[model samples]
Every structure is written in C-alpha cells, then in structure tokens.
Target: MGVLLDSFGPALWLVLSPTNLVIMVLGIIAGTILGALPGFGAAQALALMFPFTFGMTPEAGVLFFIAIYAAAEYGGSIPAILIRTPGTSAAAITVLDGYPMARAGKASRALKISLYTGVVGSIASSFIFLFAASGLAWIGLQFGPSEMFAVGIFGLSVIGSFFGDSPVKGFVATGIGLFLAMIGSSGFSGLRFTFGQASLLDGMPLIVVIIGFLAMPEVFRLMAARRGDDPEVASLGGENREANHVGLKVMRKLVPTMVRSTLIGTAVGAIPGPGATVSSLLAYSEEKRFSKHPEKFGTGIDEGVAAPETANNAVVAGSLIPSLALGVPGSGAIAILLGLLISKGIVPGPLLFQQNGPLVMAVFAGLIVSAVLMLVVGIAGVRVFALVARVPRYMLAPFVLMLLVIGTYAYHNYAAHIVIAILIGAFAYWLETIRVPVIPIVLAFVMAPIIEANLNRAMVIHGGDLSFALTRPITLIILGLAVLSIVLGFFRARRARHESAAAKENLGETP
Candidate 1:
C-alpha cells in the first residue's frame, strides 16, 4: 500500500507529460470517431493503432491505448442512441432505450446521460484498479481449470437465453457457435475440422465473427430499409435547448443505478473473458428487474440508457486489473495491450509492482484522465455525431459496407476473412429473418474455447471423474449461480413474450 501511494506522484508526472498528453488526446479523438462507426469497435481500433505505438515510450503507449479504450466505450453509445446501430456489441443494450429516447425528441438528453454515467463509472473503476487490482487479481488466481470452466458456463447462462422468445432457437444458435469454435487443431487430435484450408487452422477470428454477425447485418438492414430522414436528426434541429442538460434532479434519480452497475461491471470485468458485453447485459437486466416500472425499460427510459453505458465504460479500468496484476488479458483489446507490455520487456504478475510500480501507477492515473477526456470529447462532438443519422440511407449503407470490408481485411491482412465475413453476414441476416437471436451465438463462440480447454484440463486432472466438480466448493457455487441465471433468464424471456402478445392483442394484431 505504501509503495502504491508513493508511486502516485511520479505516475501523475509521467501521465501529464506533454508527449503523453498529446498521445492521450489524439487517441481519444481517433477512438471516438472510429467507435462511432459501426464495425470499427475498440478492439479493431486498437488493432489498427498497434503499429503506431512501436515508436512510443512504454508509458506513453499504455496511456494512448488507455485513452482510446475508455473513449471508445462512450463513443459506441452515440450511434446506438441516434441510429439504433450499436458501434460495439457492449452498446447493444443501449439501443433498446437510447433509440426510443431519441425518437421522443430527446437525442441530446440521452447522449448527455450516457456521457455523464460513463464518466462516473470509469472514474469509480479507476479507483478500484488503483486500490484493489492486486487483491482482485489474487482472487482470480485462486481459480483453477474447473472453476474457470464453471465461470464460462455462468457467463453462457447470463447471455444465452436473454435474446429471442424461443429458447430452442437460442440453444440451436449456441450449439452452432460452439461447433464453429471447435474447428482447428486440438492437442488430443491432430486436426478436427480444418478441411484443406490453412486459414481455418487457427479457426475463425473473433473479429471476423463480430463484424459478420453483428455489424454487417446492420449494414444489410440499412441497405434494404426505405425509411425517410430520422426523427432523431429532426429533433436535434428544433428540440428545446434545455433537453441537452441533465440537471441535478435527474442525476439524483440515476445515482443508485450507476452505483449498482459500477459494482457489477467492475466485478465481472475482473473475471476475464467477454467482460464488457457480459457486464452491460447483466447491468441492463438487473436495472430492469429492480425498476418499479420494469415493463417500461425499452420505452425510452433514462435508467435504461444509464445502466449499460455506465457498466461498459466501467469495464475499461476493471479489465486492466487482471492484465496488470496477473498477466492475464481480460478481453481482445487488453490482449493487445498485454502484447505491448511484453514487447517492452515489462512483465506483469505478483512481482510486477516491485519491479514496475511506476509504470503501472502511470497506467492507473491514465485510466482516470482518459475517462474525463472521453466525457469532454463526447460532449463536444455529440452534434457532429448526430449528423450521421441525417445521411441518406442509400449512401450510408455502402459506406458502412465499405468499412466492414476494410476493417475485416485489416484485421490480419487476409482476403479470405473478407469473403468469410460476407458469407457469415448473409447467413446471420437470414437467421434474423427467422427471428433467431444472434447474441447467444456470439457469447457461445467467445466462451467455447475457454470452457473446452479448462474442462479438458479438469478432466485430465481428475482422471475423467465428473463427480469432482460437486466436491469443489467454488465450482459448485459458480455452477449454482449458472443454474440460477438460467432460471431467471427463462422467466424473463417468458414474461417478455407474454407482454408482446398482450400488446399485439391490444392493437388488434394477430398473436
């Protein structure tokens, strides 16, 4: 504790240096713009900017990535609110209420809420990173293969059934995703499903899957839909000036939601593996469950926008906890940052503080500073971002398609990825046409490798005895939580379906 406190002053000096500050601001600006574009999320942004960090000092490079990482979380909400297109999968929850709020002539209000709550969540998370990263990382270290497998199962339960009315379709989608993840070489087997292509040897990249299933479908919809100018854009032109201001009364009402979501985000983020998306989904569900007007969650409510935005931004700093303290990358972007640290010959582990306290502290300081800068830049650029909604759908579709192609190709400079993305995008579009949820597929794909490898190792350790999980307390607890999550998700989906049926009947539509 004394060492951490002592390093704070030097950390501040390092972060506030002129070169670092410039890198911070530049990274934030670039991140915001790229994040506002569908298909170009934080991971993609970091991957694109990776080469630029080669010439920078380690502290400056870390600070630069931190700035972009935090700002992208805030920037993703911009498109989600104004156009119903989430720039990142984590921002998908924001679309449920953010777009509806914009339709109610309060686009500016929603943007302000997202900006403010995101800043609050990020700041709180930074403090957690500064004070408890090592402690949290130590807790993480206690998990063995079985515990991690159970954790992966718990994550699946939290996300799998939340989408689509039919649980069967969700299950099928998840099965397909797991199957996709199983392609590529295995330690026990030479090769399982990599036909003749060398590219499939590594399996499908998550970036390709994300772009195809999530972003490209939006592009297809934009190209196909024949809507006029958006109401959000018109509202921006003539809405009341005060609509942009989130006053004290509104802030007070949102305090509890922000607090709850911050805790959820930070805790989940420290666990590793799809933390941002999972945290946002969990926070949104929790807020809806806790609200007196639970049924009104997707109907342009302030809390809906606040919950997920806050959680996703909080994930930025929380994700760094494991990366800095345990040498474990919590997400794809953090993996890139971890690579940077390794390239710089900075090892992160139990002895990291003793060996590299100053640099780690600088990163801690940079997280908070970048969060504040995100708020500033987000507010200043809101008007310009809203202009995206005003672009003709015809023009917007091709531009977004161009971005999808470029981003996919840029991921590994592989042409095959572009073709695969287009194919998967078309398939995903067809799945949406049948009302099957894609969220389950994405969550399942991301978790499958972790679950498989961990389960395999656990089995090997226990001599293939499955009963050992019941004897391990932590594994039992996590599996219990997974079962509970599954039950809750089932009920939630059932209630939502019933409400949809009732609403349709009230409007004289067929069931």
Candidate 2:
C-alpha cells in the first residue's frame, strides 16, 4: 500500500496542474458538443481528434482521450430525452422512457436524472479502475499464447450470445474480419496479399477502416432518410419550471437503482465485446425485474431513465480495463485508442507497469479528474447542448464525410487511404443491413495476428507438437473456462425462450 501510495503521489499532482485541468475542460466541452449531435459519437470524435494527439506525451494524450470518452457518454442522453432520437447507439434504450417524459412535460427532470446518474456511475467506475488495474494486469501476465488465443475466442463468443437468435451471421462477420487481418505481407514469409497494388503493402490503415465503419455508415443512413425537424430546446409542452425540478425525494428513490446499474455496467464493460449497448439493455431489464412497479418502466419513469443512463456511462471506464490491463481492447473505439498508445511508445499490459509506472497512475488520476469535470461542465452547458443537439442530419452528414476524407488522407498523407475508407464504408454499411456484428469483426481482425504469432512461436518451441501448447496451466484453465462459459450461455438462452413462451401462455389464459 505504501509503495502504491508513493507512486500515485506524482500522478495526483499532475492531475491538479493547470495544463491538464484546462485540457480536461476542453475535452469535456468538445465531447459534449460532438456527442450531443445526432449520428456523431465517440468513434467519430476519437478518429477526428486522433491527429491532435500526435505530439503530446503518452500520459497527457491518454488523459485527453479519456475525458472525451467519459463526457461523450453522458452527452448522448441529451437528444435521447428531448427528441426521441439517440445521439449514440448505446443511448437507444434511453429513448424508451426519455422521450415519453419529454412528451409529458418533464424533459428537464429526465435530463437531470440522467446527468446525476451518469456522474455517479463514472465516479464508481473510476474508483474501480484505480484499485483494480494493477491486479488485473498481473493476472494478464499469466496468459500464454494458448491462453490468449482462448481469450480471443471467448470474446468472439459474445457475437452469438448478443445477436438475439442469429449466431450464423455473426460468425460470418467474424470470418470477414479475420480475412482483413490476414492482408498485407505475411510476417516471416516473402508472400503478400496486396494483389500488386503498392498501397496495400501496409494492410489497411487503422484510421481508414475506423472511418469507413463509423463515419461512412452514419452518413449513408442520414442521406437516405428524410431529415426530421430538430426538437425545441424547451422539451416540455409549456415552460413549467416546477415540473422540471428533481427534488431530494426523487433522488433518494433512485439511489438503489443507480447502485445496481453501476455494478452491472462495470461488470459488462470489463468484458471485451458486449459493450454499453448490452449493458444498458441488461440493466434496464434487471431494473424492471427488481422494480416495485415493473409495468412503469417504459412509461416516463425516472428510474427507467436513471438505470440505462448510469450503466452506459459506467461502461466508459469499464471498457478501459481490458485495453489497459490485458492489451485487448474492450470495444472498437478503445482499439483505436490502443493504437494511439502504441504510436506514443507506450505498450499496454503488464510491462506497462514496469516500464511506465507513473504513466499508469497518471491515467487513473485523469479518469478521476474527468468524472469531476463531467459533473460541472455537463450541468453548466446543458442548455447549450440541448440547442446544439437539434442540428439537422442533412447538414451534419456532409461535414462528417469531409472529416472522414481529411482524417484518412492526412493520417498517412496518402490519397489511397481515402479511397480505401470510402470503399470499406460502403461495405460496412451493407453489413449493417444484414445485422452483422461489426465490432466483433474488427476485434477479431486485430487479435488474429497476435494469436497467430504467439501460436506459431509456441509450436516451434515444442518441436511441432500442437498438444504441448495445451499443457500450460494457464492455457488449460482458460480452455476450461471457455467451455463452461459456452455451456452457461446455452442454458441461459434456453431459459429465455421458455420464459417468453410461458408469458404468452399466461396472456392467452387471461383473455
């Protein structure tokens, strides 16, 4: 404890400095503005902001990015409450009750509940990041090649568990991602998959692929649809201040729901692929089960707003755990953030602690500071954000396309990347039509090369004996766990079907 305390002392001091504080404020405001805009989110913001971090030290770069991460999550709930449109995909569940509250003349009240829960969840997740990081990194060091490969497979299994009755399509998407990972020159072999195109030698630039996936799909959707009128800043039927105030009595009632949602969000975030969308939905479902008035969940209830808002924001910190401690990104945006860490000469995982101990603590301090900034900055600018959230998709889509083109081309100063990003964007947009799980595809692509390199190295060491790879104690443990996880998932899926059928039968009997 003394050693930990001494190490954290310098990092704490860094967070208190004026420069870092100023950057935190800037990130919060920028993230709120960008995130509150329809069809713009963390991925687009991170990609667009990636160039700005090129010259900073790794510690400061990470601090700035995390502030964007924490604040953007809270910002998403703004449009979700007032306009029946989710600013981010994870906020989709918030629209269920949030819009209803607005229509019923309590939009401001719903916004306050969302803001308060988001902060509480972020604070809780930051504490978890601070205390749990070292232990998680230590455990990550225990993984051998086989163990890591098993871990990747476990992450992929989320595709089946989450796709809601369709595992085949998810696996198909995973296969494509693996194929993308196999592009470029084969590492120790003199062969390449570039098809004689010179620009393909480097595989796809990470930024290009990210832009294609995030920016392109959003733009296409906006272009094809008729743009709706943006909502009014005053979300209520009338500007009644009394109905929009969340007093102590209501806050006291919401405390238990927020606590439960925080725990759920942190757990889901630590896992690699399920992300905030799943966490919010799961928390919403569980909150209903735990509620005294379960039927009121989608009926403009404050608890409904609080449950999902807290879980999704908590996921911001939760998703960082695997990326920082295990060197495996928890989501696509974090994968992009991981690329930034590598570019800055800071490799994540166990070695990170040994090589850059102070930087690790600085990261923790940054998260704590971001949580404080979110509370102050979010409330102060709520009105401005509400106004900005009304920006039309038609005007915004063209601006996003410009960002995608410039960000891709400037990253490597290659026009080829711009073309590649557009092509991939078109492909990714098509994948959305089929309900493919794109994030898992990107994650598998990133992990495939790592898994391949390690597996081959292990095989050569064991004289071409594949069975010897399974003999490592850590590898065996992860394999066992993987099997157990699949079994549990199968049963859980079956139970859900049974419950759904039983509900239908009960309804029939009542009629």
User: Could you give the C-alpha RMSD of every candidate to the true structure, in order shown?
Assistant: 3.5, 7.0
Displacement of residue 292 (Cα, Å) in model 1 is 2.6
Residue runs of model 1 more than 4 Å from their true location after superposition: 37-39, 82-85, 100-106, 184-201, 227-245, 493-511
- What TM-score, over all chains together, does every model reach? 0.88, 0.63
Summing lDDT over every window of 10 consecutive residues in candidate 2, give the lowest-scoring window. Answer: 229-238
Candidate number achieving the greatest lDDT relative to the actual structure? 1
lDDT of 1 by residue, 1-511 (tens): 6798799889999898888888999999988887877667788789889999999988988999998888888888887887666778788778878888876667788988999999999999889877787677877677788988898888777666555656667777888788888888774567778898888998888768877777777788778756664444455434566765688899999999999999889987887665788788889878987998876877899999999999999988888888878888888889988888888888877688888888888987998888878878887887776566556556678887887788788778999999988888899999989988776777688778888888888999999998868989999999999899778877877887898889888889644
Quick one: best TM-score, which candidate? 1
How well does candidate 2 score on lDDT at residue 162? 38
- Write down the lDDT that model 1 would get: 0.82
Error of 2 at 82 (Å): 11
Q: Tens digits of per-residue lDDT for model 2 on 1-511?
A: 2344566889889877898888888888888766765545677677778888888777778888888877778777886776554557677668768878876767677888888889888888767767775554454445555665665555455434433244456567767777887778775465467888888988875556545664577668656645454343224443677887877888898899989998888877776655776678667767876887655766799988999899988887787877776788867778888999999878988577666767777776777789888889877765654443344556656765675576567677899888887788789888878777565455456456656676666677777677854678766666676566456556656776797899999999995
